[model samples]
Target: MRVLHGLEEIFAAKGSLLGTSDWVTVDQARIDAFAGATGDHQWIHVDPERAAAGPFGATIAHGYLTLSLLPMFMVAVYRVEGARMAVNYGLNKVRFVTPVRVGSRLRGSTELVDAQPLDGATAQLVFRTTVEIEGAERPACVAETVSRQYFGD
Candidate 1:
């Protein structure tokens, strides 16, 4: 993980490559729990046996499930100390470039695309995050994530 000493350090990191996260497995248990949580339960996401005969030859993780792991993965990416809080502002663009199959390992590559001071002690940060599937040439998902980070007074 890359640790920035202060909010100013993060602000100065605009357009810099932040860091990548550790790999996470997208197993059936995770897919099933996600299905239960979101009530998606689609055959392609939760039905392994049926999906084996269908496209991809295996149960695939939901696109949103891949998207939902961003926050969890970011824990290993970077952090700015002395920041009072950080909140998800919004997402600018999101694309599921490749299907994430069950048992696949995924990791996030993050880059700071933009940053602007919101207040004397706050800044709006934009990160271009791409979720890369293990051993795949293409990324599973790509997104522009906006966030608000409040510095300590």
Candidate 2:
């Protein structure tokens, strides 16, 4: 895990690879739960039996489901201490490069792409993250995520 002591540390670490997260398996149960919660019960994501013959030889995860794991990935990758609060600003460019099939293990590799001082008490940070599938030639997803960190006086 990469831990940044302060805003300056974060700023100084820009353009470097922060860390890679531990692998998390994308199983049927998890897919089903995501489907239930999001009301996205598409056969490709939730119906393993039908999906077996449809494509990919098995049920695959929704693109959003794969994207939704960013926070978990970030937590495993790094942290910036001495910040009063932090919030997700939004995502910039996001691409679902490859499908995530059920039973596949996935992890994220994060790089600190940019860090800017917004004001005396806030900073804006951008991270380019790639979600890699185990033993795959291509990543499952690639995204540029933005966040804001607020510091105290």
Candidate 3:
């Protein structure tokens, strides 16, 4: 994990492969929980038996579910010190190129794309994050995630 001293130091780097996170298995229990929480009980994601006859041949994780794992995965890759708080500003772009089948292990590779100072002692950071699936040619998801980090006054 990269220890970023300050927002300025993070901005100065052109692009950095921050680090990879520990593999997270996308299991049926997790998929069911996500479905119950988000009310997205689609057969492709929740119904394993039906999905076996459908496309992908297995129950896959929802795209949003995969996208939502960014925070969890990113935290495993790096940390920002001297900051009061960090918040997810928004996502500039996101694409799910491949399905994340249940039981598949996934991890994230983050790159610092750009950073801009905002009002107060906060800065906006743009990161190009890719969620890679084990043994998959295409990634589970690729996203440009934006975040705001607020430091001490």
Model 1 steric clash pairs: none
Question: In angstroms, what RMSD does candidate 2 have relative to the true structure?
Answer: 0.7
- Top TM-score hit: 2
- Scored by lDDT, the top model is 2
Please list the residue runs of candidate 2 whose C-alpha ends up more than 4 Å from where it truly belongs after superposition: none
What are the per-residue Cα lDDT tens digits for candidate 3 across 108-136?
99998988889768898999999999898
Location of the lowest summed lDDT over 10 successive residues in candidate 2 = 46-55
- Model 1: per-residue Cα lDDT over 1-153, one tens digit each: 888776678868988988999899999999999999999998999888999999899999999999999987777888888888899999999999999999999999999899889878888999999999999999999999999988866
Q: Give each model's whole-structure lDDT.
A: 0.91, 0.95, 0.90
RMSD of each: 1.0, 0.7, 1.1
Alpha carbon lDDT of residue 74, candidate 3? 94
**TM-score for all models, in order of appearance:** 0.96, 0.98, 0.96
Candidate 3, superposed: residue stretches over 4 Å from native: none
